[model samples]
Each structure stands twice: as C-alpha cells, then as structure tokens.
Target: MNPTLRPRRLRQSAPMRRLVAETRIHPAQLVLPMFVAEGIDEPKPISSMPGQVQHTLDSAAREVERAIAAGVGGVMLFGVPEHKDAVGSGADAPDGILNRAAAFLAERFGDQTVVQTDLCLDEFTDHGHCGVLTAAGEVDNDLTLERYAAMAVAQAEAGSQLLGLSGMMDGQVAHVRAALDAAGHETTAILAYSAKYASALYGPFREAVDSSLTGDRKTYQQDPANRREGLREAILDLAEGADIVMVKPASLYLDVLADVAAVADVPVWAYQVSGEYAMVEAAAANGWIDRDRLIAESLTSIVRAGADAVLTYWAIEQAEWIGARA
Candidate 1:
C-alpha cells in the first residue's frame, strides 16, 4: 500500500525542506520602511503598529545602523512634517524634514545601503491628498506633475539614491524622469508604485504618516477589484522609465504582483504594508498564532509570488533570523 515515490520525503525534515526550498529570502533582499516626524524629539511609539515608532533624526540614524549591521538592503524614509499646507510646500524645500533626513542618511551611509525617499505630498498637504487640488477641490493632474518634478529635483539634491514615486499621478514617471535629467540628477533612480491599490489595509499607515485625508484616494489609487489594471499600470510605468516597479500591500495582491513581475525588466519590489504587519501583531498578541514563523512565512509568500525585494517592518528581525538560519 506504500507509494513508490514519496514527495513527503523533502518535507519530512526541517533541514530537508530548507535545502530543497524553491524560494528563499535573504537579508539583502529586504528593505525596511521607516518614518521620521518633525516636532518629535524622541522615538514615538505607534499604537496601531505595536513595535513601530516615529523616530527622531538621531534615533533614525541609530536604527539605520542596526539595519546595516543586520545586512538589510535599504531603508525607505517617510516624513511627517510639522506644518501642512494647500500646496505641500515642505515636500520639496531644501530644508524640509524629509530632505534633511535624506541628506543625513546619504551622507552617513551612502556606501553602506541604498537611501530611498517617499516622493509623495500626502504627509505635507493639509488636505492629505497626493497632489494639489483645484478651486473645485478636484485633484489637478498636470499641476500635480509640476509639483512632482520639483520634488524630484529636491530629493535628488538631497542625495536620495532612489525616489519612490508613490503619488499615483498620471504620467508621473515620465515627468519625474525628465525633471531629474534636466536638473542633472541623471543617476538618481525611480521606484514607481505601479500597482498600488486603494485597499482598506492602509489605516495604520494613515496614522504612521499622520495623514489628514479629507476624502478617499479612489480618484488616484487604482481600485482593488481590477486585476488586469494592475499590470497595465506597471507596463505604463516601465514605459515611462521606472528603474524599479512595486505593488503595495503585497500579500493581498499576489496576482497583481505576479502580473507585474512577469513583464517588468527591472527589479520588482512589494510593500508588506503597515496594516498587514499590524494584523499579524494583533493576532500574535492574542496568542492566536506563532509570531516569528508567520513573519517568515508572510515574507516568503510575497517573494514566492515574484517579488525581488520586499519593504517590510520586520526587515531587521527577519534579517537576523535569516542570518541565524545560515
């Protein structure tokens, strides 16, 4: 009654499973997304996200050092400015909080890891929209492009090696690419948030960035129900000269991630977003699931779905686990 060939042989032992695993995760393939807020002199804990914090400039540097020591690939920076305005003037200012942090990181750790900045206006704008609005309160697309172009130059000037174009504005990639080149920032790269969906999993993130959203972002962000549209957006970003493309809230959109990865010539990354991380922490806090194992499993699933790299809150811990396993 015994089978002649047993597939379970590979899954029989931990070592066997490790050795024969088709997908693997490494420290170098993980990127940690961090927040640094103005008006906070200390690392402020975020309640929705149990283990995350809004770090001070110095604390942020210390955290990045830990990430480097753990061999995490990169750090993505988001800024929570002290002031908000109709036009998000702080977003591209030379002395803006985001720009200052970008310059600090680039100056301190340029040779150690990639320095990336979120090129979005939501955290700076009073309306909490990704772009400027007209007198009628509708987002102005072409005018938004102008703001993005200026932000691109500003970020480049601050030494951001990778600009995360996450605003979801039309023609954003082309506009930013032309702006960067015209300003002689030819080497700074773009990581387009190509398949970002207007998902319900961004609640914790809104808190993370101190978002002052007036209305839903459905006007710009893609609908979660559209699968083909995800790939279409990625293709458009690629055509517009994205050095890398990413899908946000990665786990819920494996199909979209795979679709983009299938056609993308550059590296494909995914964001294991704040809400996704918070859900796991909440479950683990209630003793409902094994914490460490699920973190590894969640990340592995995203990579298996075709992500070349992942931006996760667990990047440091996961990298440590990866090293311990090695």
Candidate 2:
C-alpha cells in the first residue's frame, strides 16, 4: 500500500499516539453527581444503577471526602426527601436534605472542591414534575421560576458554590440569578442545563431518585430531533447570566454539546446520565465490553466533541485511572 502520507507513523507506539492525542481526559475535568436521601440509616443501593447508591447524609459527606481525595473536580448533590408536596416546599427549606448535605459538604470541604446543588423540585415534588402544576395539570413555567429562585437562594445560603438549574423552566436562569444577587450571593455560580432533552435515557435516573413521574417532560425539555434549538437554549442561558451551560444525556447528544461549545463564552459541560452508566455496567457484567476502557473512551469522546467538563458516575474511578497513568 503506497501512500503520500502514512498516518500510522504517529500510531506506531503508545507514547506516540498519546503525544498526538487530540483530546485528553483529566481528573479535574470530571464532576460526580450524588444523591442524599433523607431518613435513611444507611446508603441504599439503587437497583437500576449497579454499584450506585442513594446515600444518607453521613455517607454522602464521607463520599465527598473520598471524591476530593481522588481529585474529582466537583460534586453535584440531589436531595430525596421522605415526603413530597404539590409545590415542593422542601426544595427551599433550610432543613431539607439537599440543603443540609450542601451545608455539610461546604463546612468540611468548601475550599477543597466545588459544592453544587440541584435546583429542581422534581425530587421533592409529589407529582414528580420539575415544577408546580397549573389547574389544567400542565407545568406552570412562571410559577416554577419562582420556586427555582427560592431554591437557588436556599442552596446558596447552604454554601453551594454552584446551582444546577435543571428544571427546564422558561427564564429560570435569569430568575435564579436575580434571586441569588438579591440575597447578596452574587458570587454564587449558575450551571444551567441548557440543552436537556426529553429522552428515554433517563430511565435509571428515575429509580435513583425514586421519581413519581407518571408522564413525560416533552412540554418543557428540548426535543431530541432539534439540534439548532439546543444552541439557542445555550445562548439564552448565557444571556441570562449562566456561568456554565450543560447538555444532558451526553453520549446521545454529543452533536448538541459540540454546537453549544462552539459559541459558548462560558464553560460547556455534558452529563453522562444514569441510564448511560447503567448500560455500560450491564454490558461489562455480561463480559461484553472492557469496562475501564469503555469508561475512558466514552468520556474522551465527550471531551473530543467539545465538552469542557463532564458529570459522570465514573468520575472517582476514572480519576484514579488517570492518576495511575500519570
């Protein structure tokens, strides 16, 4: 095979390939998403997500410590309350599980790692919708914005450095930012889930959070068929004062992530959601794929597609792997 150029020259050795790698995954670019369940005596394993648990407050703190030691960039905390209400009042209560977990992490490792909280009502809502419902049972976008603002302030007061607005409410970023600044938390950051799509990839996440959702979220979340809409959402979030923009279900939405990253002035992130993790684990358990190698490859592809950071279930373990190689 004669050729003008041999690309194999650079792929001849491990060192050569690594040196010429266009994308690199690092420990500091990975964020761990954790759940702290209220009234639990111990961490409860999520059946759908193998090896993942709904942690108690104490267990969550210890896990954060370990993640910091592993050089993980940050942790995004979600709270699971024992009770749920129509308006999701627990979401803004100072004594709520998520708020308490945020405070605990901040007090122990505030300067050690970035402490972020999910500013959505779904986990705390009886109906399992991300926001309050109207008389017609439709999601009330304006009312949800108010709830999100209050939740943002509560999370900020609990020392969350970043608020992850994942509710898919209109003007949520602007409303939350205004509320934070009004509460004298001007420095607190907003990590908006700008391009979240209503996809089947969220199945495992419902089990992890014990969600009660009876229907879909297509009314608010972006449609999977629209790529341009994802970019528009990112631009809207940036204009609304979002510090970071994220695309959810990363593996299936790498194209959206790339488009968002192209024009985003702020950091762009992608979430390798629960279902994605579960599928990999399931395949690995069946001896179908190399788990470690797949993890590294999946994350590297997200980075190569233009994600500045990734929220992944494999954060801690992958960080350790990177460290081992280094």
Candidate 3:
C-alpha cells in the first residue's frame, strides 16, 4: 500500500471521476410510464403523484411525442377506464382506453420507438384486482390467466410491441405467450414482472389509475425479504418464453434486480415506482437535496445493478436533461 498508489489520483478532478465511472445511463435506456383515462376531455392531475396526469387521448399522444423528442427509449401506457366490471371487460375490448392508446402510439411512433402496454386489470376491474375473482371474494389464479391471455391478444392487436404482465399471477407468461402465438402474433414480446413485491411504494400509481383496491396484493405479488425467491420467479418467467424480466420498486430492491439480471438470459428491466419518484421530488422541493444530480444518481445505480432499461415517471424530464448535457 504505497502512498503513491492512493485513489486520490483518480479522484483529483471531476473529469477524472467521470472517466472512471462504472455505469452509464443514457436517455435511450429509459422508458416513460404514462396513464390515459377514457372519457377525459382534459388531462386530470394525479394529486398523489404531483406533475403526473391522467391524460386524454390527444394529450397522451402529445406527451409521447415530447418523450420521443427527448430521446427516451419507449413508453409504457396504462389505461384508466370510465367503467369497470367484475371480469374487467375493458381489458380485452377493442375500444378500451389501453387498446386505443396503444394503437395511437403505434401508428404515430411506428418503429421509431418501442410501444409497450401495461397488461394488468387493476384499472379496469371494479374490485381493483389484477384479474378475475372467485365467488369466495379472492383473486382466482387460473381464471385470471384466461383473462390475461385475452388481454394480451387485445393489446397486441392494438399494436403493442411488448406486453408488460404486471399482475404477478402464476403462469401468466406462458398463458400470454401461448395466446399471442395462437393469434399469430409471434413477434409480440412479453415483459414479465418477475420480482414484483407487494409494496407500499405503489401508492401514487394506485391513485393515478384510480384503483379500488380494498385489500393488499400479498396473494399474488412476491414477498420483499427473499432474494432467492426473486431468482426463482425470473427462472420461471424465462422458461415460459418471456422476452424480458423486471423487478419493481427498483431502488429498494437493487439486490433482487441484480440477482434476476444474473440468471435472466433475456433483457432485464427495473421499475422506479411512483413512491421512489415522489420521495425524490418531495425532498428536492423542501430544498433538502440536489434534485437533478440525485435523479441521475438513482437511475445510474439501477443501470449499474444490471437493469437493461428503467421504467420511470421521470423519463421525459431526465431525457431532456441528458439532451441538454449532450
């Protein structure tokens, strides 16, 4: 350990530190998550997630254009329907908000960017479960699979390039994949929510989608404590022909994201969930932190942990900042 071998040499200048950085985060590696509500004449602000809105079709398209201009990788669309049913019929209806929004983005963006849709029923179902329910008032796993398969076909028909199976239902990847293939949509890929946990970090998203969740998702989503369990979920998803696997609430679960990325042969993604964004914004608003720097740091950490892409509310904003830097 000679004094001349000290790390201070490399840390002597900002440019030197930048050159030695281990992970790189580009605007093109970020995906923006957007919400489109049916029957909304004007964009409705989500109070829980400040600056986020449930947009009308036109506004949604405008936002996508802005994101594209900012150089983001893609967008993940969520629909907030004007109606809900026990079976979540809107999830498969051609006229559903999600279906129509996907079509709009596809027709506008084409191959310029990837168009993904959130393949979940929470925003469409009356009870706010991500699937069909049983008479016993529980989420029926097998029944949900059927509904998800139908939803997948509907999304693919609406021009969704990738379907994000965020419900955490068992066998969902296989069911959706089979349905897409049967419908001759062999190119429609599946992004499996492999390590999604039942977390409090989803509060803002629930408000954004106007969720009616009366109970927790512990029955379907993974437990937060088990790292090995996360790996197991990724393996199952990969076996079911998933093109990508994801870990939700990325900041709190980087270790889990790392584990999933290690074994997943396909691309691995991480969702920087609503709460994560809110906390950073809140702290910055209070002048307790340097917001822009922290945002870049948080996103870079996820990339450093091996996430191929990150789903974030800050995608467009971050992309703009990156563009400015460039």
- lDDT against the true structure, per candidate, is 0.95, 0.94, 0.92
lDDT by residue for model 3 over 1-326, one digit each (tens)?
Answer: 55756878888898998799788778999999999998879999998788999999899889989988999999999999989999999999999999999998899896888999999989999999988888998999999999999999999999999999999999999989999999999999999999999888999999999898898889899888878888899999999999999999899999999988877889999999999998988999999999989999999999999999999999999999888866
Q: What clash pairs does model 3 have? A: none
* Lowest lDDT 10-residue stretch of candidate 2: 1-10
What TM-score number comes out for model 1? Answer: 0.99
**RMSD over all Cα atoms, model 3:** 1.1
Off by over 4 Å in 1: none
**Predicted candidate 2 versus true structure: per-residue lDDT over 201-312, tens digit per residue:** 9999999888989889999998999999999999999999999999998999999998998999999999999989999999999999999889999999999999999999
List model 1 lDDT by residue over 1-326, tens digit each: 97989898789888888899999998999999999999998999999999899999999999999999999999999998999999999999999999999999899998999999999999999999999999999999999999999999999999899999999999999999999999999999999999999999999999999999978999899999999999999999999999999999899999999999899999999999998999999999999999998999999999999999999999999999899879
C-alpha root-mean-square deviation, candidate 1 = 0.7
Task: Point out where model 3 deviates above 4 Å.
Answer: none
Model 1 residue 202 CA deviation (Å) reads: 0.6
The alpha-carbon deviation from the true structure for residue 82 of candidate 3, after best TM-score superposition, in angstroms, is 0.6
Q: How far is candidate 2 from the true structure (C-alpha RMSD, Å)?
A: 0.8
Residue 279 in model 1: lDDT: 97
TM-score of 2: 0.99
Reference-based TM-score, model 3: 0.98
